[model samples]
Every structure is written in structure tokens, then in C-alpha cells.
Target: MVNNNEKDKSSQVTEFSKEAGYYLQKGVHCLNRSQLKKALKYFRKTIETDPHNTYTHYNIAYILSRIDYLKDINETFQEILGTTYNLPEASFLAAIYYSLTGEMDLAEKELEKFLEIAPEGEIMEEAREMLNLLSGEEEIYENLSYIKLSEKYEGVIQTVKEKVKRNLECPFFRVKMLENLYQLDDDLTSNIIFLYGLAENSTIAERVLRHFIKSSWAKEMHKELAMLALRDIGAEEPYEVMMENRIVKVTLKEYFERIPQWEPQWYQVMEKALENIKYNKYHSKTMEGELKEVWNQYIKVAYPEIPPVRDINLWSAALEYLTFKKRGINLNHKEISLKYRVFPEELLEKYKEMGQALSR
Candidate 1:
């Protein structure tokens, strides 16, 4: 059923993809051999041909970090994370980047994400050490200013109470100190976790309580106590539910200061639409931010009586189309919808709805 012109076009596209794959393999091989310059050479070639390849971009970010070219690494890192949510290595690297930059809150949050998702590996141990380092609780990993002070059961407990009373240490340090003591005196683990849970850093407390529940260091009773502490803190995965569909674990409040009062579905739909943009031609960081701004603007006027979506991909593609249209780019809606696996008619309908929503 295909015509000669379509076949030729498909053949050229396949050949181009093959060229990109060849460069990617060469880059990986050179990287494995510790040939840094050659690896970068090939990786750059891969990016030129297949700019949206996630692993190729990740390799470049890794190399850039290794060579101390960190100025633009965050932008590169965030772009990769946007496309691939399950890549724990990016999160681990991002955490280290944040720590070096003195953004402890972001660093700790990234490390928690890495620890939660990364399976058993050498990186897992390193992530734990990084957590300790970020908290200034250990003398690990080079000659960092932080040092491990020796602890005795009685002395450590007394120090914890005295610090809590006098406010000698910050909330994070106080929690880490209690964690050390919890290891020393298993019998008082519940009491220690209770103190730890109420340490004012609810985020860190919620994180470590779950760590205790999973780690072998905590006894069964200690695990129960950790769970109780978690409940007392009242922190749960997915602080809110999306009435439109399934659950998303992230709390957008961390990302947005004053989250819109719209239903959670709009947010989830936006995220799904964004996810659908990964590895495509529309996956630039600037474009992603612009699309989000578009969503925010659209939702501002459309909220409270906004339309529901059965196909988030169609919504996503239409979002891109609408943004292009607003920018006067004149992208073909039919072609865009086909690329996103939706009907042309449906995409146009959604795009019109979005435009009208913004008008109101």
C-alpha cells in the first residue's frame, strides 16, 4: 500500500538511525577503554544524529562531571531526568552536584530518590556514604571537613538530649546523631526514633524511618518502631490522590510554592504529557519549560470546569501543537497527532478546546 516516495523516505530514516547507533557503540567502547577524548568525539557524533537518545546524553553528562566541566551539568542532568525517570545514576550524580553546590535540601532529596529506586549495587553503598557526608555525619570519601566522632552508648544518648535541649546542632545533624545512637542501643531504638521523627525535619525523618524499615541494621522491633514513627509523622506516599486516575508519588508542592486549586488530574495529565515528549524532537529543556508555562496559563483560565482526557498522549501532542501555533510556527496538526499515535481530528479538537480555554 506504500508508495515509492514513502519507501525511500523510510529507507533514508533507517539509514540515519543506523549511523547514530554505530557512533553510540563506538562511544561506549572507547569509554570502556578509558579513552576519554575519543569517547567524547563519538558521543558528540551520536548526539548530532540522534540528539534525543537518553543513554548517549547520560554518558556525556557522566564524562563532563568526571572532567570537572560542571557549569552546565545541571541543565544537562535535568534534561536527562525529564526524559528518563527510572535512571537512578542520574539522580545519584545530581545529588553529588547539589551537595558540592551547598544545596543540601535538593541534594538530600535526590539521594533519597536514588536510594529508593536503585537496586543492590556498589552505587548503593556510595549513596549511603553520600547521605552521611551530606549530613556531615561521617569521615568517608576523601578529606572532607566532616569527621566521625567516636560514640559510646551512654555518652551519645546524653549528647543527643543535651543538643536537643540546647539546640547545639541543626535538625538534620540531630537526626543523624540519634541514628548513630539508635545503632548503639537497640533496646531504646523506639525512643531514639521517636526523638528522630520529631526532629523538625519531617522530610528527613520520613525518609530515614523507611530506611530503617528496610535496612538489616534495625531489628524487627526497631522496624515496627520506625513504622510507628512514620505514622506519627503522618507522612505518606502521594500526599494527594488524582481523582482522574492512578496515583503519582511526588508532591508538587515541593516544586510549586502555591499549587493551583485545580483537581489533581490536571497535574497528572500534564506530567504524563511531558513524559510523552521524551526522546522526541520536541524534548528541549526550553521547550519543556515553555510547555509547562502554557499548561499553567491554560489551566488558570480553564480550571473548575476543565475538560477530562481519555488519551493523555493526544492531549500532550495537542499541547505541543498549540504552543507552536501560539508561537506562529504553523506545525501540521495531522502530522503531529500521527507522531504521537493519536488521530488528527482528535488532536485538532483538543487544540481548539485548549485555545478556547485560554481565551476564557
Candidate 2:
């Protein structure tokens, strides 16, 4: 007969295994619901119980890459694949890593290997498309030259179009390419706004705008999109473009009805003008009249109760900072402005040359 101690140990092992399975299932449920944080907690519990589970390791790696915390990711990918060389998820993820790091040929090979194993799943379709993109057999993005973007980087724009066509699921990649296109000429960026407006998917348009909103041009486009969404969707509103940036509670009819009015409670055409003026405060002839008019009128009514210029400045500055970051520019205006007494004008001017030329 087994000793009591050995029996107890065996029982404990069974209990731990059961608990690990429970948490793994819970984690999957959370992932299905898009509760990534909760999913991660459950996954972590599973890891603590079954440290050697390669499938668990693969799940963790996939989540990590999605959140963009890919430090030592190469090693993690290696660990997962090293444990289970034939795992489809492991191969697909490894291919993605390779694609991002410029290992196109390796990425294609890994994806092809994955398709060979699981050729019927949705994942297989994605892998096949990625393979086409990596091999340059099909362009990644659709050519949007008909949209009338700037001509300066026609070649790069074509490349971007190819990338977009190939990987429709990767919002980050699409946004990145649009950014590169915009840098070559602001006119192209402006045209992107128009192109994006024509997009059937709001998520895609949002990605395009979010990628570039820090720039004056992109912000201008976003304001346009916001208006389009408002007008097209018929959002209810009291229609105040608050001195505050946050969308205040309002009605759709009110917003539409007030667009042409000059009443103190509502601002319509002036919203875009003022937004432009905030960044381009030291304006050229184009912005001077409008800025001065809004500044003079707005401060008179909202003085003492108004939010500080510093607040507005900081907000716009934060946006500018985000744009610069997206472009791989190192300057952080918030810190610089606080520490050395720098101004938006200087930074604005630097980007303006690039920002203004995006489109005509």
C-alpha cells in the first residue's frame, strides 16, 4: 500500500494541475472578452503552476507583442519555438517578429511553414497574405495616387499603398507608412485626410488620424473628420466647442443649427480657425485676421472664467510632441518648454516647413 505522505503529495499534484487548467480556461475567456489585463492575471497564475507549458509561454509572448513591450522578445520567441517547434501560433508570431525586424525572407519562410500545418484557419489566411507582402509578390497597400496627395515622395507613397493593401489588419503599420508619406510632403498628409474620409471603416480612419494628429495639418484633418462624423452620423449636441478641448455634452441639431451663428454659446466655423490659430499664433497673413478676431472675441466673454493659455498651449504642445515622436524626432516640447523656457513657435516653425508642404 502507498504511504499517507506519498498519497497526500499525489493529491496535491492533481489539485495543482486542475487549478492550472482552470486558470488557463479563465484566461482564454478574458482574452475573448478583450479584457487583456484580467486575461494576463489568469495567464500568470497558470504560468506559476506550470512553468514549462510552452503554449502558455506562447500566449504570454503574443500578448506582450500586441501591447508593444517586445524587449527580449526574440529570446521569448526562441523559447516558445524551442519548446514546440511545430506550433502554428509560435511560427506565426516568429514570422511577425521577423517582418518587423526587416528579416523578410525568414518571415516568409516561417509563415509558409505555418500554412503547411494549418491551412484552413483564419490565421492561415493572414499568414498567406503576409507571405505575399514579404515576398513582394503583391503590393502591401493600394495605390491612392488618385487622391491627389503631394508628388514629392511618389515612390514612397506607392510603397505605402502596397503595404496597406497587403496587411489590412495592422493598423500600426498603416499609420507608420502614412507618417513617412506625410514627412516627405504635408500636402500628401492633407490628402490622406480626404482619402481617410472615404474609408468605410472608422477604425482605419481613426488610425490614420491618430497617427498624425499632433501635427497642425493632421489636427486640421481630424477636425474635419470630427465634423464629418458629426454631420453624417447626426450626433445630438448643445454644440459648444468649449474653450476646453474635451467634447462637452451637446445636441446634434444644436450643433448643426449653430454652425453659422455667432452667438456666444456656440462656435462652428470658428472652431477650426481657432484651433489653427492656437498653434500658428505667430501667424502669417493667412491666419492673422481670423486668430485676432477669435482671440479678441473669445477672451472678452470668457475672461477670468476661461481655462489658462498655458493649459491650451500644453494640450496643443502635447499633440505636437506626439506627432514629433511618431516621426522619430527626439524633441519633447513639454520638458524643453518647462526647463529652458522654449516656445511652440520655434518648434512649430521647424515642423511647419514639413507640415505645411504636405498638400496644397
Candidate 3:
């Protein structure tokens, strides 16, 4: 039922829409790569090409909000909301902007609307917390260090206590939580020692041994476990405090014969030893020489394509490159890469190629 002029206009509109879609895809790709300036440019082009596109407006608003382009953010967000788009994400962002600007009433209203629209949204928990905070139902201590520590450690303490009270036999879980707590505050030496005593698993014991070797509390409360752990892990150093405990010495000797004597595979051993050394931990030094020898053997066997290099620096690079190629893990040293005039993007592409080849 269309005339020739109308048909030509329709064809032109279709072509423009296709071009706009291409620009939109480019914008999204740039955004994903964190190229904020390029993304904004492409998005603005998309707006020029297709002024009625709500998604383009939303994305531009999001970028502007992140960059604190406060003058334009509200207008852009309002444009998105004015459209027929059901944008709960926009509402959430608007709420955050309002909160930042000290417009509490507006922020509360936007958050409430966001909840009503998307009750099971990704930011629901954060929204609820913010609402509680805004309503003064929950206290947010700004300057109290003790209150902050109490808040941080309370959940861990409560979970462990509840498990203990219920007579739940999840030693692994208890020890894992204790390990996290220990990492948070090494001053919780007594608490960790108590939990370690109750758990006594080999994994937990090793973690405790690595972290608390110098702790007086650990030596006083967990001497037996520490001695047994060190012995199991083939530690050469003797603990003076543990040696003074007659029961610990006797127990250590009893368990010494039962510990496994097998070694892990060369690659795994090399990785673990290197990681420990990287962290300035000396627990893996006994295997360093053997690990270097194994690395040479591995390079000779697995990476025949790479030329042989005898220098430790070149050897390290070869090892890191081959490991990355084989396992898709980025073991390449950033400083070394800079020395060699290589870039992270180049390494990423190499890794991607390796992954694709493996998939084939």
C-alpha cells in the first residue's frame, strides 16, 4: 500500500538502524574492555544515529554516572525512565547518585521503586542494607576501630559457636572459618589455636603451622599439633617449646613413620615451591635445587619447540611461557615482559589461541 517515496524513506531508515546497531555493538565491546572514552564516543555516535534507542541512553547514563558527570546524569537517567523501558537498573543507579548528592528522600524513593519492580534483583541484598542504614535501624560506626573489628569478626565467631553448640561435626568448616579469621587478624592467635586443637585435620594443621610458627600462644596451646604438623610436612627445624613437652616429642616420633614419603609431580612441585618462595616463605627451599633440575627436564621434554636456554633468566621466561601455553594460566612476569618488549594484550591473545587450539 506504500508509494515509491515512502518505500525509499523506509529503506533509508532500515539502513540507518543497521548502522546504529553496529555502533552499539562496538560501544558495548569497548565498555567491556574498559575503554571508557572510546565507549562514550561510540555510544554518542549511536545516539546521533538513533535518537529513540532507550538502551543506548541507559548505557550512556551508566558511563556518565560512573565518571561523576553529575550535570548530565540526572537528565540522561530521566530520559531513560521517560521511555517505555522497564529499567530497574537505572533506578538503582539513580538511587546511588541521589545518595551521593545527599538527596536522601529521592534516594529512598528510587530504591523502593527498584525493589517493587525487581524484588529478586542482583542488588536486592545491598538495597535492603542501604534501606536499613537509611532508616536508622542499623548503626554504621564511622570512626570506632573496636566496633569495626567486632562487626568484622562477629559473624565468624557466631557461626563457629552455633556449630559447636549444635554438636555439628564439621571440623573442616570450622577450621576453614578459623583460617579466614586468622588471615584477617593474626592477633586472634588464641582463638585459632583453640579451633586448630578441635579440628586437627592435616590441611588445617599445615595452614596453622605456616602462619603461627612464632606465636607464643600457638606454642603454649597447640604444641602437640604443631610438632606433628611440622614432622608430617618434613620440616627440618625443631621447635624448642615443643621439644620441652615430653608428650609432644613422643607423639611426634610415633607419627613420623606413618607420614607419606611420596613427592608430588615435578610441575606441581615446581609451581608450589615457586609460589611459596614468591611469598617469602622458606618452607619450600629444600626442593628448590631439585625443582630447577626438574624444570630443565620439563623444558627438554615438553617444550621441544622452544630453543634451549641455560641462563636462569631465560629459563624462567621459557618456563613461564610454556606453563601459560599449556595450562592457560598467566605465569609470565610483568617486569620480564616489559624487558622483552612484550605486552599483556599480546600474551592474552596467545593464551586465547592456545585455548582455541585445545578446544579444537
Candidate 4:
């Protein structure tokens, strides 16, 4: 015969457990969908309801680690460590985080603790491999170079190339090829672009340009070249906003001047140039000859002693130097002088005067 008070407490505990399980399931569902914020909210509610839930703690730490929220991640892992409950899995995950961040000493400590407490399972094998690598007992690099590794994956490369050649317009195929080649070698990655350039498929070029702009791995030079290729084909207007934000006026001036006055692409080039010039008032002179005259008149009015240069290239380069300096960039006047065929002393003097006026 159990007491009534004990029965009531047992019922309340069971209800709370069920509610915690429900929230945990919801959190896992949101996490799988990559709704990290929502998942974190649900996980927090679960923690509030069931303070002893190790799985929820692990999930919270995992999400925090993935997002690189290091402060919160460290606190959460520390909380897990302080718990009396055995969570060897948490130690394993901490080891991985430390290893990725190059904290080899902390990683080794965590890995050793994980191996000491973790139950025998598939993770044991993984833990052993990590320990061996950390201890320098195993040579992690059997091949050493991507070149040698690429030979083993030649079939994968050929398949991607075949798919790309079969349907040059298929962005999926091109993106897949780029991904595969990028993993293999830098030369292979460049080869994909070279092949596309030779084909002169404007559509393919546009797709590749957008892909490069969005990719984290693509260098600034790659993005610039992609934009230049698009500009050459007059497909640049679609990316006008991105171009306006990223490209320097000197580069934009060259792009607009080099645009061919042909039948199909002329309007696109003119429209893109006009739109960009309107948005970036500083580059109005670079885009339109009439605007350049107006700018010279304004400069003559403001500074009567400093006469404008007759050479458009030198003027443009000077403007670029001024803009660069205004943005706190350290300018190499000698390099600019050699590149633009302007006297370094003259360029430096103009830059100093421009800096003074700008300061005022």
C-alpha cells in the first residue's frame, strides 16, 4: 500500500519526463532541418524541464560547436563535464572540436579521457585512430600530395567531364565538375574554367561567375576574372549590384571601355554602366565623357592652382589612388607610377592634397 503523496509525486515525475521527451524530439527535428535557432530554443526548454537529460546537453553543445559559438560551447561542455553522469560521448565530441581548432594538447587530454570511459563500440575504433594520429604513431599522410591522390580518383574526374561535355548548359553538371576538380588539384580546377572559356558559352560563363561569387573557397582573383568574363559577353548587368559593391572604379572603367558596340550586347553594357555610375557618384567621370568634363570644371573651381591632367588613364589611376587612400589602404606610389606611367612625386603630391581636402 503506497502512500498517496508518493503516488502523486510519481505521477508528476512521469508527466514531466514525457513533456521533456516531446521537446527533445521537436528539437531534433528542427536540428535536422538546419533551423538552428528554433532547435536551440526547444533544447533549452528540454533542459529546463529535465535537468538530468544528457542527450539534450550533448545536442546543445553539438549545435553550438557547429556554429562556432566558442564561448557558449565551452560553457556547455564544461557543464557536461561537471555532471556526475557518465557521458564519454561528450568528451569524444570535445576532442574533435579541440583537434579542429589546433588545440592539440587539449584534444589529446579529451581523447584519453574518452578512451578510458567510452564503452566498446564503433566509436572505439575511431577514437583509437585519432589517438594514434595525435601520438604520432601513425603517418597520417600516406600519399602526401593531392596530385598522387588525384590519380586514384581519375574515374570520378572523367565521369564529371563526360557529364559536363554532354550538357554544357546544365549548371548542376558544371557545379559538380567544379566541386570534383577542386577536391583533386588546383590545376584541374583551372582547367575547367579554361575549357569553358574556349567554348565561349556565355550562359555557362554566367553560371560559373555566380557560382564563384557564392563560394567560400573561390579567391578574389577568381571572382574578378569571372566578373570580367561576364562583362566581356555583356552578361554583367544581372550581377550589377555585386559588381558595384566589390569592383574598384578603375577596373569598372576598363570593363565599360572594352565593351563592344555590337548588335545584341550594346544595350546591356550601356545600361549597366549608367546604373553603376549613378549609384557610385565618385566614378561618374569614369563612365561618361561629359561627366568627366563637368568633374574637371568642378575641380578647377575648387582648386584653381591644380590643373587637371589631359591623359584619361593617368587621371583615372590618380582617382583610384585617392579612393584607395580614403579607404585607409596603404598605397605604393612607386608601383602605381610605374603601372600608369605617371611620376611618383606628382602622384604623391596630388594624393597629399586630396587627403587634406578630404580631411576638411
Candidate 5:
């Protein structure tokens, strides 16, 4: 009874539906293996192949809900909530999405709706947990049938601890943990690190961060956190940071003192020594910068009580030795002493002073 054109259109629609089903199956398979990127790609194919199938969109949001590290599905959440009423889980996804975006009121409403509609589902407990976290009665993250979030945050915590003990050249996440912590979900901060922040005893933590700031290896946040650490302890009103990017100044109720300054002659003699050993020519800026940082840090600790610049060539030799030691690059003292035409014991004496000052 139908025309050939109508028949062709019907055939094409059926084929597209089959293709969408195939992509949906493949996407779920990848998701079971924790391959989020691949799953998202296949899910996108399903959407593109069957644009009229609104349930496909809901499925995507439902699967991805509360995974805050992933990108937000803002309009998708709104569309599923406003227009699509069949899937109660759309409300669940909306709750997590809104919470991540800092709309606590909207998140609470969505969670309330989700709890009312979906009394029994895979994520019913997760929804309840989220509601509790929003009320400040508990933390937001939950253990689910699929993803174990507690283990994941626990892993990040372990790696961060090892890195803290090993190198002061910290990654950005560590700095984020120390600052702007309220922006993060609760599971991320459930450790001694957050405890220190709460106790306002960032003394040991701040000392380590100060070393990071003074090191040549300091990144941008390292510089900023050093100043903020001062404010946290009721230390100083105005602090000067050596690294100049954009200037920022804030006062916190804490205690701190001004940082120490090194004599310019120390750097000049160190550069001359670096040239003597052909160190500057090989790694010119690195050799100079590292020596300057080590010299200044020792000065910071032992300032006013620091020794006078006598027989600066001997001190230059010691400065070069200390810089290498700070980097965990061992240089033979006898070898370094000879290179600077200084006696080994005299260089050792100066080097010992530098090391002892930092240990304080």
C-alpha cells in the first residue's frame, strides 16, 4: 500500500535503530572494564545514530552521575529533568551535577525528587549518602556496585604522601589540597593532611612548603602557597615572594617572620666557581640558579648569625657542594674541593655549617 519512497524511509529508520542498539551494547561493555573514554565515544555514537531516542541520553547521565572528575553534562541534565519524566535517575544525575556546580539548593531538591521516585535501585544508597553530605551530616562520596571511590581517593592519598617525603617539587593536586579544599568532594580530604589544616598546625607542613618555594624547582602554586602558609599561622602581615608573576597580597590571622636575604657577593663567587668547574657552560642557568637558591635558604635559617664572607673562594666551593647535595646528586667532597683549589677539610667545615643550618 505504501509508496517506494515511504518504504525506503521505513527501512532506513529500522537500520538506524539497530545500529544505535549495537553501539549501546558496545558502550556498556567498555564501561564494565572501566574504560570511560571509550564508553563515552560509543555512547556518543548511539546518540548520533538515534537522536529521537531520549532514553539514550538518560542512560548516559545515569551512568556518569556523581563522577565529579568527569566533565559536567549541564544542558543534558536540564533536558532530562525538564522534559523526560520516565527516568527517575535523571533526577539523581541532576543532583550530582548541581552539587558539583555549587548549586546546593537545586541539588537538594533533585535528590529529594530522586529518593521519592526511585525507592529501590542500584544507586539508592548513593542518593541517600549524597543527601546526607549536602546537609553537612556526612561526606558526599559513596561506595557503589561498580566504582569503589574510597579506594581511588585512598590511592591518590598514598602517592601524595610518598611524593611529599621524596620531593618538595609537588604536583598541582597537592597545592589544590592545601588551598581551595572546600571546592573538592569530601573523600579527597579524609586524611591527616586535612586534619592539620583543621588544627591550624601547618607548622611542619608549611616548613616543607617554604623549602619548595625557595628551591629552583618551585612551580607557580608553590610560590603562592608559601605566602599563604605565612598567613595561616598568624605569622606575618606582609610577605615578599621572590618569584614575580602577578602580585597578590592577603592578610591572615597567624604568626610569621620576614624571610632572610643573602649577600650578592655569594652569588658572584659561586658563578666564578661554576665557571672554574665548567659547570655553568654545560648547565649555565641551572648551575647558577640552584647555587643561588641553596645559598639563600642557608642564609634564611642562619641569618644575622651567619658567618662573614671570608676567603669567598672556599665558601663558593662549599655552595656548589651544598646545591648538588640538595638535589640528591652526590659529588665527592675531595673532587669538588680540588676543583675550587680549596682544602678538603676547610670545604667540609663550610659545607657542614650549611647542612646543619638547614636541619634546624
Candidate 6:
């Protein structure tokens, strides 16, 4: 026969289970309400007894991120990564954490692995979008690193040539490697002209020139190459390619006498390049608070009549903010609220001043 005391004890245990379950549900509700602190307390209590609950682990991670507890966030992510429990949730959260902490390689690996396991993950759409953005950023960094490495090592061209022969096509590495070569070797100018003109795979060369023209050294190299290939070789067709592709700035026009054979098409491309440069120059110039003061007066005079539009102020604010503040925009748009409305000249000037101060 069951003893009355043992029955009472069993009842007490059942009541405790009910209490714990209630608290766990309430904790989740609190998190949904953005009551981070209240949610944290209940979650902590539930996790203390039910340590293996995957939902509890995921929720703690979310709340930790909200409160900006980076160390805790990373630790929680490590835990999520370890779990054989709830893979889709684990991977999705793990990817986010890895990305936030700038462990992009790890994040990418986790995301890819996640897709393999759960191709249609619960957050698959969001995961794909985030993956696209993160991978793009990784590609940029990888490309930059490759450029730097190629610049550092003289043997990079041979290495790339070998890779190309092996049918290894890393667009990022190839494009940057070509750029480094163009900067270091004048002989590469002919190669550059040929690559841009006659090669079937001209996209890499095109990208190289796009990145090259941004730097003074590369821009000068491009000009030199243009003069050599266009004047000495009398390759009017290639010159047309340069101009048509906007391979270099329009300022190179002064170097040539009669335009290339395809003068009409060439001039048209130059016109487009000049227009883009002009538009960008206007934004940089009119944004009176941009950190680059060298071009400030030139731009101001160049577009004297152009109004100080909201875009101009925004561009100025963005440049100064990025250059000086080094702030990251991970938080909600409303929380970091940058006003995008139009402002009068007086207001614009005030904002510019504010930007300048923030820049300093």
C-alpha cells in the first residue's frame, strides 16, 4: 500500500514541476515583450535545473546580444555550436554570432554546414540574405588581402599564371593580382592594354582598372600605360577600349592627338565616366564637412550653383562619421536614427559643423 507521506512528497514534486514550467513559459513571454532583465531571471532559473533545454540556450543568446554582453554572446554561441540539439536554430544563431564578432570565416563555415543539414532551415530566407551580405564582405576582405599579398611578393604573378593554367578561377584573387601587377610593372601596361582589349576574359582586367584608378600610384601608371600603348603601338582600337570602358579618367584625353579609330564610341564612354566622376565629386565637394579638405575648395567652386541638398549633407555626414567615428550600424535604424529629411542652407551648415566636430 502507498504511504500517505510518500504520496504527499510526490504531490510536492509535481507542484514544483508545474512552477518551473510556468516560469519558463513566462520567461519566453518576457523576452518577446523585450523585457530583457525580467526574461533573463526566469531563463537563468529554468536553465539551472533544465540545463540541456535547447530553447533556453537560444533565448539566453538572444537576450545577451540585446544587452550588448559580447563575451556572453560569444560564449553562448560556442555552446550553440556544440549542441547536437536543434541544429537549425543552433546554426542560425551561431552564424549570427560569428558574423558579429568578425569571425566571418567561421561564420561562413557554420552557415554552409547549416545549409547542408537544413537546406530549408526555418530561417532559410533570412539566412540566405545574411549569408549573401556576409560572404560579400568576406570576399572584399579576402580580395584586399590578396592584393596586399601580391604587392608584397614579386612571385605572385607567376603563382597566379600557374593557377590560371590549372583552371583555378578565383575572380577576387585574379582581379587583385592583376591590379598589383599593373602598379608594379610598366611591362604590365601592355599586358593590361592587351588584357582589356583582346582577351576573352576581360572582366578581371576591367575590375582591376576600376580599383586601380582610385589610387594615385595606379592612376599615374594607367596614364603612363595609355600614353605608351596608344601613342607608340598606334593601337587605336585598344585606345578606344580604354576610353569606352572608362578604364582611366577623362583627363587622359590631353595625352592624345586625334582620337582613336572608334572616336565616337570612345568619347561617349569618356562622357559617362566624366559624368559619374562629376556627380561623385559634387557630393564630396558640397558635403562641406567631409574629412578630405584637399578637394573641398575645388569641388565647392566646381559646383557653386548646386544646392546643398539633403544628399549632400547626408554624404558629408556619412563620410565624416565613417572616417572619424568608426561607428558600426548593427542596431535598429530607429535607435540610431539619422534624419534623412531636407534641410535649409543654414541648417545644413550647422549639421556640417556638427559633423566636423564629430569627425575630430
| The best candidate in terms of lDDT | 1
Clashing pairs in 3: none
Clashing pairs in 4: none
Candidate 6 lDDT over residue span 77-190, tens digit each: 344344334445566556555554456777678778777887865556655655666655322223332222112111212233233323215656565546545555544443
What is the clash tally of candidate 4? 0
Model 1, residue 192: C-alpha shift (Å) = 20
lDDT by residue (156-265, candidate 1, tens digit) is: 22244344434424665555555554566643454456455444446656666655555545553354345444555666743332212432233323212223344556
Write model 4 residue lDDT over 205-261, tens digit each, in one string.
567655665555664334444554455445645453234345333343343333222
- Name model 1 segments beyond 4 Å from true: 1-165, 168-301, 310-314, 326-328, 337-349, 356-360
lDDT of each: 0.56, 0.47, 0.46, 0.50, 0.55, 0.42
The TM-score that candidate 1 achieves is 0.30
Off by over 4 Å in 4: 1-73, 79-85, 139-360
Model 3 / residue 205 / CA error / Å: 38
Question: For every model shown, what is its TM-score relative to the native structure?
Answer: 0.30, 0.28, 0.26, 0.28, 0.30, 0.23
The lDDT of model 6 is: 0.42
Pick out the ten consecutive residues of candidate 1 with the lowest summed lDDT.
147-156
Candidate 3 TM-score, true structure as reference? 0.26
Question: Least lDDT summed over 10 consecutive residues: which range in candidate 2?
Answer: 148-157
Model 3 stretches astray by more than 4 angstroms: 1-71, 76-87, 142-325, 328-360
Evaluated at residue 102, the lDDT of candidate 4 is 52
Compute the lDDT of residue 126 as modeled in candidate 5: 69
